[model samples]
Target: MSDDRSPSTPPAAEALTRCDALVLGAGQAGGPLARALTDAGRRVVLVEATHVGGTCVNEGCTPTKTMIASARVAHLARRAGEYGVHAGKVHVDFPAVQARKDEVVAQFRSGNEQGLTEAGVEVVMGRARFTGPHAVQVALPDGTHRAFEAPLVFINTGARPTWPDLPGLQDVDALDSTGLLGLKERPEKLLILGGGPVALEFAQAFARFGSDVTVLERGERLLEREDEDVAAALTEALTADGVTVLCGHQALEARRAEGGLSLRVRGPKGEKTLHGTHLLVAVGRTPNTDDLGLDAAGVEVDDHGHICVNDDLLTGVDGVYALGDVRGGPAYTHAAYDDYRIVRDALLHGTHRSWRDRLVPYTVFTDPELARIGLDEQGAHEQERPARVYTLPMSKVARATETGETRGLIRAVVEASTDRLLGATVLGAGGGELLSVLQVALHGGLTAADLREGIFSHPTWSEALNNLFMQDPVEVPGAQERNDPR
Candidate 1:
């Protein structure tokens, strides 16, 4: 007997390619889930509107981090004298840096495409929208149309940078996070709007690249989601690097100016006009649900435009699910990857997994990376959960002093009665890498004592965890201490 099955091909125009499952948006979730379903002997059709590897590979993580790495190297080279290395004057090659970032993005995207192709998943390039509850219509990239029907449909269309509706802002040329990554020439002066992680990361990276960067945040402080001390530390760090931070300021208008653009901003003091060679709006991201035809599929979205889903990531309609930024919980690539696992287990393994109460870890790739897992000091207080908070300055860490990177601090929040680790924030050098140590401990249900008493390597950043957990709970100046009910 001869086998009749051949490799999957793109759907013909005006044709319908029926499959057991249809995965939309080749993001962190969709791509992985497609491969998983295929490996489990299920027919899967994965459709991507733009590029493969979704936002993380094409724009968010892969490309941004590659540029961030270049900026870090440039920064370190400039500081080589502190390390007793006579490194000559360092100059940033902006074009080369952009080229390297492009190379990395291409390599990642190619790998994702190859993986899906080899997995026997039918890959289609198109903008997909639901024609009905179980049927989807695609406008293919080649100006062709195709339809698909599947019992199980997953939407992972990810998010895009949000442009604020400031007056005259749209008329003037500005760079979003995506646009910033593609710049071949470094701006002489960069004015950033937004104090969030994305905004701060770009601010620092451009500053390190020798741009006179200024961050104009409407919020009262940077990283407002974090504790006040964390915000202060980050502000100080950015300031030390010569980045002017203007918090509690709003951009009222924008216009073309000599040599660049000018923004009129309103601050506590008064109104001021700021000029810059470039403007970056890193305010936030909105989900890609508007064009997905959710109404036809009976899928619900919240006021913020994120698809409404249950704890298991299922949409309102049966057999239809949403994951990643589209579903809108944590907008991290790892969160989306975890969402895939939850869906896979529920669909194939007969095991139910929920996103409820799951611990998500995130890192900001600044000079001294800011990494956090679980609740921070403010979260504990806001929830009114009785917790003990221990704060340790990086100055106390031997490795930090030896490396001349004693600029940040480490804070751990633990359950007062059970001694369980609740959360931690690491803001020193290698903070992101070091947060994993506590993440593993948290996953294993280890107490703060476990981390404090564990034998850590000598003169290393991980060893700082020992001192962080062992120290007495320092009294936060304006924070009230609550008694544990237990």
Candidate 2:
């Protein structure tokens, strides 16, 4: 990270290119912001070190989900007998899957590049360093330096995978999320080093693709942020998919093995040796802010290296703003785009929309997806907000029962006093898609009774809501469902 360096001195004046705005990285937020700034008749310069699209198209969402789709086909083929289809034995073509993923990624990246070209955004392919509050110098590919000076500078370099601090881990050639996406050979036995969404999603996908996958989570449970029941349901689904999920386990050390890789782990029982063809460390990611010499611009970053920003996404420095994963909270592609919108309106329309209190919904791309929005049961308890929890097994949903994909649950929390919907978690097939219904209801201020009494088309997941909200509410402590709406 640039934070480790001394303050940057200004670049040569003759080589500088002045622009109305400078975007540091062509990530989710920075790419769109660059074009938008150009549309506003402002000369925009977009500096990208590698690909046109950031983690999303190049590594994270696009490539991974494409392979997940391939894995889903293998999973379905194995279960074809249940659907009365006589499909042959399922086998994954690892190279073919990689090719498809690469093709999709290339198309997305080219689209972004084409758009930037049409919009006349001057793109300097280089690593960016802040020389001052309004000045940035780029170390170009051909050993030349290019500098940009703008009144407004946006940082959107996003984040990358962080390695865990286990002894010998770095020496072992373990894969990060990006590296895993590009692996040439499928692991015969895969070991995952985290319990978060990245670990869980990839665990299920590779397991379905025929890898003997083991997940070692340091916490007592996977998705420690989610409610116990919700996390348990997801863990069960992954286990049923043939993934060995070991919670409360920490990697003591890692080393290169005879055939692949070896990890020594400790659990409640005792220390054990786990062997795998590959290891993926999906613990988390840190911002790219550290290497940009933010201190030179007087831009503050949190202890974790995330750039500090206010409700308006404005940094401490007046002309500088940080967007997307670099700004820290809610590191999702959609959230990053919304950051663009916030700053877009503020600068172009003079309307400073806030970053606080935004509804961030996310889905884990597993067989039976885990989608969540707003507060969960534990959150209500922590906030000491009165709430009523209602849970329905997927077995109870007609669609789930009919499809024979009844492996998860849908849980909702409603404000006990007013019976208004607060949050919902969907953990079933197409759960991510189903979550939009709950999101819409919450966004529209719909109540439990409203959904319970509402009519939905027959045998659809949406129709399950009629019975979901009709269930007897589990009254949480200090919370009771009331007949009064107000």
Candidate 3:
């Protein structure tokens, strides 16, 4: 399973190989799917152009979160005096942080490849293109082509970073998420272009690492998918961390300026030019289906190149399925893993549920982390659903007071009819963990009343949940003015 894709001379002719399953892109889903297919008594061939563990391991979550952890340590070190503990001046070794991230990624990726090898799954390192329905041609880095045809084909090619269409974009070198992680030296000032999870996470992390960071969000507000309160609190948190946030800003052009790169942007204020040492385009990602020749395989893709699939993850083609981020849903690793589970159950057990039933919990790796599951207050109102909202600032949480990390809020949405949990958002320290507690409650169909009466350990973040449900639900939007604050 040790694949080296170094370029070499091309082979004379291509040869075709037949297998029971041909999975494209050894990403979160494809990696496990290949192994499980082999275990199910089907021969599997996994084609990956790069690392086995996809973006999470190679570029996305693993590397970024690892660096975020280092950034967190640096942040805490600077804030040590808040706890009545004196600390010396802190300095960050950027290379050392990068090394640790690289090490963890290597371990995870190597383990993925090793598992595939042990499971008897053949691994091919190359670019895959569908030659026909249930058939693919892979061009290896050595200028050689290998072909695979299988009754069962899975598309898990994932995605790549896409830069916005701005003038002079190509003329100046701009870093995508992958390129940002590969920086040998931290930029004196980092200009981030986007307001999504990816953009904000890096914005906070790099700023904590002592870089001058500014985030330009085209939307009128950051985290457009979130409620105004949640987004505003995050904005305040980042501002307190010394990161400048400009909302309603559109980059009109990019160009080379003295000492580095420059962006000509139009904001709510007016047209202005900003200079920075590096530019990171974190606007969005495009699925890798562009060159996959999906048309040859009768697979359909959305306007954004995301493969469209049904609840069963089938692409409306016989024996072909699409999963993970490529399938056009929540682009989280857990969702991708569940996709493998769904597909595996259909393939093996012949029993599966609608994909819509799954819960997608996500966390922004920012300080006083932001975590969410199910719906939010705004979403419930948008659907005109009968739901009640409850909110508690982190300052009220006992553990938060004890830890001196109270710069966020906790919010919950409950079904007014059922009294059961509809969704929740936590924007404080250990927010992700808090989200997990709510996730279990939502999964168990526990009512907010149940949580309100539920006893929890004192002076703990989990205990804050008990207090979260103590307050009366905010008046339904449009009923009257509400007192709930972010």
lDDT of each: 0.89, 0.90, 0.89
Mark the regions of model 3 whose C-alpha exceeds 4 Å error after superposition. 1-12, 477-486
Q: Which pairs of residues collide in candidate 1?
A: none
**Roughly what TM-score does model 3 have, to 2 decimal places?**
0.95
The residue pairs that clash in candidate 3, if any, are none
Q: Over the full model, what C-alpha lDDT does candidate 3 score relative to the true structure? A: 0.89
Each model's backbone clash number: 0, 4, 0
Question: CA shift at 193, candidate 1, in angstroms?
Answer: 0.9
**Which candidate should be chosen as best, given lDDT against the real structure?**
2
TM-score for candidate 1, please give it: 0.95
Q: Which of candidates 2 and 3 reaches a greater lDDT? A: 2
Ten-residue segment with the worst summed lDDT in candidate 2? 477-486
Candidate 1: Cα lDDT at 283 = 89
Which lDDT tens digits does candidate 3 get at residues 1-486?
755632222223667799999999899999999999899889999999987999888999999999999999999999998878888999999999999999999999999999999999999999988878888888889977988899999999998888788998887789999999999998899999998889888998999999999999988999989989999999999999899999999999999988889999999889999999899999988888888888878888888888888888998798999999887788899999999999999989999776887778999888879999988988887776777899999999889999998889999999877889989999999899999999999999999988889988887899998899998787454322233363
Candidate 2: residue pairs that collide:
1-290, 1-291, 2-290, 2-291
Which regions of candidate 2 deviate over 4 angstroms?
Answer: 1-7, 10-14, 479-486
